[model samples]
Target: MLQDTIKAQLKGYLANLAHPVVLEASLDDSAPSREMHELLHEVAALSDKVQVSEQGVATRRPSFVIRRADATGQGMAGVTFAAIPMGHEFTSFVLALLQVAGHAPKFSDDVIAQIRALPGKYAFETYVALSCQNCPDVVQALNAMSVLNPNIHNTTIDGALFQDEVAARNIMSVPQVYLNGEPFETGRADVEQILAKLDADAPRRAAERLKDIAPFDMLIIGGGPAGASAAIYAARKGLRTGIVVERFGGQVMDTDGIENFISVKETDGPKLSAALEAHVRQYDVDVISSQRASELFPAAQPGGLHGVALESGAILHARTVILATGAHWRHLGVPGEEEYRNRGVAYCPHCDGPFYKGKRVAVAGGGNSGVEAAIDLAGIVAHVTLLQRGSHLKADKVLQDKLYSMPNVTVLTEALTTRIEGNGKNVTGLTYRGGDGADHHLDLEGVFVQIGLLPNTGWLKGTVRLTDFGEIVVNDHGATSIPGIFAAGDATTTPYKQIVIAIGDGAKAALSAFDYLIRVPATGEKHAAVLETAAK
Candidate 1:
């Protein structure tokens, strides 16, 4: 009876209010229980004006249908609630309603209209840390997107909510957005980037019309040695595997020759990549190239974890994900560096060294990579100049000794490359500053930059743990701190960054992922059965 009284009062309050009413539920009130029950009926009656649903509680279908109808109506006009928005997400939820109501502080009408036209159901969940200043912008962008498409529902969960839905997803940071239960965008995403994701995730007519389907077994990002190797091993083990890469070979595409890969005496990088691709293709692996992974998120819940998202704008679902994007060499931003790239300037000496054979080349940097490249090139090239910006070389004593012993190698201490001198077609030479503050010019055919490498983990912010240098930190078994997500290859913080080591790490990661799948024991029964049959 008390519940009935409070429900009447609440309805009267909402009916008379000039603006949308915001109510905070209090767990301490005995009247709240009665009020909540009574409120549900009142909310159902007001279904034409407002919508309400509980997140943690199991609600009845009639109540939910009424709430959804009201929500959809409000959504058409740009108004909706997060139902459980708290902590850092509280502000975002309110802002989302305002943006949907066409009251957003930012964003133009054109962007909003484009978002509204987007097809398919999209669930956008953003995980954010309280300290992120740019998070509001992301929220605004999402709200604008919601305004464009009422089907796009945006949910902002604070870092603490990991105890609920996010903990199961294994999300590590804030401002991490998940679409349809998969991590979509981490950190700040611009309007264009978000729209691109929506386009990628919009399903085809056939997929859109379908109701129920099974998720993928494995989703491998990057088609390099690690990704390809993972796909091959997983497929051989009878798991349905899918691989997505911006390009087939990754950084290895630029590699001209690779002598260190085991069993193969010496082969070109492209050939090795092609062979790996063919090996995986012979199995059940689905290879997708010229596509980039734009997002990753948790799929199911509790024990078994899986998720899906897009590369560019194509939505893909998978049970497991292996990130093997690999590492990219840091570039020295100088004039003509881009034009001379692949012609006279290169990052990988092992890949492009043969082209500079019998010609003068300058190796930049003072680290082990530079010294090693210089030593290796001294044997093949006619002359090599090791340029060190520091006063002394930073390589180990053994490499330093080897560099000194090379007759054709010239050590230029405190030498800093100022410009890459090259014609429109090819490199001719370079200018540098010597230790004595004197300018020096080297007439060279190639400039091999053996500087440090940067892992492709920038997109992972707020989603996974990263080292100070931005490499993904993994355990001994290649398992990242984020459960169900494994990383390998040069992108990891492992000591050895060689092709052989990367392959070994890839194998370990694949095995670790397999173990995770086994522990879950939910979906892969067919795969396990297939494996057993093959063994027999």
Candidate 2:
């Protein structure tokens, strides 16, 4: 029976085989030849999955033949083959295989039942790293899911084979999946994540829901210190201010206690964030939280200004934009990192340090932030273990001296955190092994990672030029290479990421934006009025 099933699946795949057609195009042409090159590369990756007749011509035959163990020679039970399944439509290929394999799709009862019961169009694309050991499980799971519902079309791709395609689509990591050309998940995601993506990507059926959004005088893209400062100043200027943030407090929310922020004697991160939100609300600032800006484009032809598109399908038109989208804390990328986050594990000392005031806490990284956080937390926290992956601390002498002077602060050089242990919801402690082979687990309430930050500018690919370090390059007045689109705060290559520095830069960007708008009218209202009078 198994052999018969395998043979049946193989026959289905063989019947759908397609011969790949290649076209030679010049790079110096007016047309988009680059797109063709990407398609060719995608085809090449499937060379192993399909039978090749020529250099670029391949008969898209079943790449693999599967047979059931119990089937007889006359009748085939189970068999399957995968063709070139990558790029934007890779998920469809996966679904096709699942149908042939004769297995129900692996999804929740509601989703599976809905797919089985309803009659509608469902499209999806899944990207996966072929070399990744964990990818096949996800692929098989998704295949099972596709089989349960005939309406769903799934596409799969070998992530490594399509470098140009990945680059064009701005994919950073795999299994970086997408639905309907928008982001879905990245790296070893579960079924729930995929389901959530499907729900989010579902098209809206109502036209009346779409309203004419008002153009903003200034649209800030982050809710961190930089974005908040920009929003405050821009609102004061009486411009229609709007701040779009994926998270309200940005990386600062991870901090336990913020002592560096000017004027605040001693404050926690949540309190500071609340205050900022309240202050912005007092003005005419419209703060939209938990929404990411997916794309940015010129508002008018000939580069009049820029507009932003949010993940929620909201279109934001603005005369000026301040990209205060700050940076995110670097992670250890080790096991249990995600599981321990916000429990006993944390990214900011300013945000979570107070919770470990009487208990022990570990601070990873030896940089300035690490040193500063350790020094500040040493006074309040009972014991502080500063774990440095390197041999030495990369902070200033004064800060280093203060840290060493504290009897409770123990600087562990060449130490790396391998795993974090927690009590389900919160972190209980951590396990670390030194370069010298000394393993230790300290009983602690929290762990603060003070590693450097990575700017959240991955979405700015092709739209804006960034520095080598992925930071948005801007001039002294926060004017980006693209006019009318300025950037401030940590996301920009403006050196310091301190609150005071970010505030000053934010103000400068606002003033510069105001100046640019006066010189270049975005709506062409003044020019249109002049033309109308001239016609009269």
Candidate 2 Cα misplacement greater than 4 A, ranges: 1-210, 236-238, 246-249, 254-272, 300-305, 339-344, 348-361, 372-384, 396-399, 406-409, 416-447, 523-536
lDDT string for model 2 (1-536, tens) is: 12445445544553443322122222322222334344334443443333222222122221222222222441221222222334222333434433443434544455565445545545455655533323443455455554455455455554344445655774433455565677656544434345545554432311112225567778899987778888988888788888987656666654555677777789755467657777777898876655688777654442343567666565566778899888877888877778766446666554334445487888898988899989878987899999998889999898898899999999998898888887776667888888888888877767887789999998887767798889999998898877778999999999978767877888888888877767775662212322232234
Candidate 1: RMSD to truth = 24.0
Span of ten consecutive residues with least summed lDDT in model 2 = 202-211
> How high a TM-score does candidate 2 get?
0.51
Q: Model 1 over residues 1-536: C-alpha lDDT tens digits?
A: 22566456545544543234222222222443444445444544642334443442322111111122223353453323322333333355445434433354454454555576787787776655433433554665675666566676564444432335544664433456788877688655656567756676533321332223345577788888888888888888888788876555566654545777888899765567657767777898766544566555543352343443443334555657788989888888877788776567876665345445588999998898898889878987999998989889999898899899978989988888989997666789999977788878889888998878889878777666899988988999888776678888988888877777877887888888888887875643223322232244
Clashes, model 2: 36
Q: TM-score for all predictions?
A: 0.50, 0.51
Instruction: Name the 10 consecutive residues with the lowest summed lDDT in model 1.
Output: 58-67
Compute the lDDT for candidate 1. Answer: 0.64
Best by TM-score: 2
Global lDDT of each model? Answer: 0.64, 0.62
